[model samples]
Target: MDKYKQSLSTSTRPFSQPFCRRLMKPRINYKNISLISRFISQRGKILSRRVNKFTLKQQQLITIAIKQARILSLLPFIKFDII
Candidate 1:
């Protein structure tokens, strides 16, 4: 009778008892965090490489275009005074 009253006086978990055992357990997985870091690194690499490639290409094209325009504009001004 005393044991029965002791159990009754305590506050039991919402899950009664069995499920509470699993709920109170501590479990961990490190692979998920590693995967998150890998994803961010991969994305950063892709973006930086693309930006660098485009900048180089744009600089080359602009230089070539300006040289061509200068040659075209100056061609008619040259005089071959060969007597």
Candidate 2:
């Protein structure tokens, strides 16, 4: 039992680190299409705070930017693969 437990612990992978520690500073803008696109999924849905690792304020800003960009036709409402 002790050996099995030890083996199990050793076989487990370490927790993954986030790709970017700080994605961006404050003052997120809607005009920055490139930056805003990063926060959106391939399916055209806005990514969550947990996935983006953003604070409450930052997440809210990102959501607003995405919507604004979509309205202005700067970003697509949905991404479709033409295959």
Candidate 3:
């Protein structure tokens, strides 16, 4: 039992590391299409905070940036594969 418990603990990884190690200072920019795209899914939907592992404030910033980019047509509203 002790050996099993030790092995289980050793095999498990910690969630201490965040998805974004270095966030952009101030806020995420709408004009930065590339950066905004990273937070979007292949289908053009914004990814969730859990997936990005960003704080509430960071997530809100990202959402605003994405929306602004979409409004400017810098980023696509929906991605479509060209056949």
Candidate 4:
């Protein structure tokens, strides 16, 4: 029960209440404002989700490979960047 309540607020106490409405105004105006940046942000999110999934798949592959051989580096052998 305590954990559930804590999860509701988390670290956002400073910007709770009235400021929350103000913070959301920019997102509400995204359709009219600088459309290019919004496109970039949406694309960036899609790219990040793909990369995270790829990294998890890589870790699973590496674990299986380690079982067969003794050599596996955690660094990316394939191209991936964190945005």
- By TM-score, who's the top model here? 3
Per-prediction TM-score to the true structure, in the order listed = 0.24, 0.68, 0.70, 0.21
| Candidate 3 lDDT | 0.80
Ranking by lDDT: 3, 2, 4, 1
**Regions more than 4 Å wrong, model 3:** 1-23
* Model 4 per-residue lDDT tens digits across residues 1-83: 99989888685533223223444344333133232122223323212323323344333432343232322332122334667
Q: Please provide, for model 1 over 1-83, each residue's C-alpha lDDT reduced to its tens digit, 9 standing for 90 to 100.
A: 99999999884733122123243222111222332122123222212323323344333433343344335552222334556
lDDT of candidate 2 over 1-83, digit per residue (tens): 99998998794644343434365544367889878999999899999887877667677778999999999999999999789
Q: Model 3, 7-82: lDDT tens per residue?
A: 9888464333353536564447898887788899989999998788677767888899999999998998999978
For lDDT, candidate 1 versus 2, the one ahead is 2
Highest lDDT: which candidate?
Answer: 3
The window of 10 residues in a row where model 3 has the poorest summed lDDT is 13-22
| lDDT at position 25, candidate 1 | 27
- Model 4 vs. true fold: TM: 0.21
Runs of candidate 1 exceeding 4 Å displacement = 1-54, 74-83
Let me know the TM-score candidate 1 reaches against the reference structure: 0.24
